[model samples]
Target: AQSVTQLDSQVPVFEEAPVELRCNYSSSVSVYLFWYVQYPNQGLQLLLKYLSGSTLVKGINGFEAEFNKSQTSFHLRKPSVHISDTAEYFCAVKGDTGNQFYFGTGTSLTVIP
Candidate 1:
């Protein structure tokens, strides 16, 4: 079984500053990792994913994450953030066999200007 853990429940950052949202997972077998962002009153949107090949994967809105298999971590990072970036981010992992996906509790990003 695969599970995800988000270290922070909320992350507050100043506008135009860099921010990193931590995520960790555990699984006996290889799995796919993903990051999703949900704006206020909206559904989740796929931020990025690590299927294979590159350890570093880039996503929308100048965001990127490095997959560390040894550490079992996939942390999301953005160079600079804006007020509009304020939302709840979730880290999820899906096993190679089943369609089931495990998700984290979620980290709320509040950007202050």
Candidate 2:
């Protein structure tokens, strides 16, 4: 079994500021990780993923995440943000062979101009 947690429920950053969204997970088996973002009035979009290969993964919109197996963490980061970057971010964990995915509660990122 696996579960994910988003440490912060909300985060506010000024425009062009760097931001990091924290995520932690617990699982008994090998897993794949993912980060998704949902902009205001929009559906969830896949930010980045760690399906295999490298531990560091980059996604769309200048976002990236590094998978830390020992720490059981997959945190998202962006060097700078835009007003349009404001959205809800979620972390997910899934067993390598499972169909089910465990998702975090989600963190709201508000980019203040």
Best candidate, lDDT-wise?
1
Candidate 2 residue pairs in clash (backbone atoms < 3 Å): none
- Tens-digit lDDT track of model 1 for 26-86: 8857889999999999999999999999999999988999999999999999999999999
Q: Find the 10 residues in a row with the least total lDDT in model 1.
A: 24-33
Per-residue lDDT for 1-113 in model 2, tens only? Answer: 78899999999999999999999999745899999999888898999999888999999999999998889999999999999999999999999876998899999999999
Q: Where is model 2 poorest over a 10-residue stretch in terms of lDDT?
A: 27-36
lDDT of each: 0.95, 0.93
Off by over 4 Å in 1: none
RMSD of 2: 0.9
Candidate 2's TM-score? 0.96
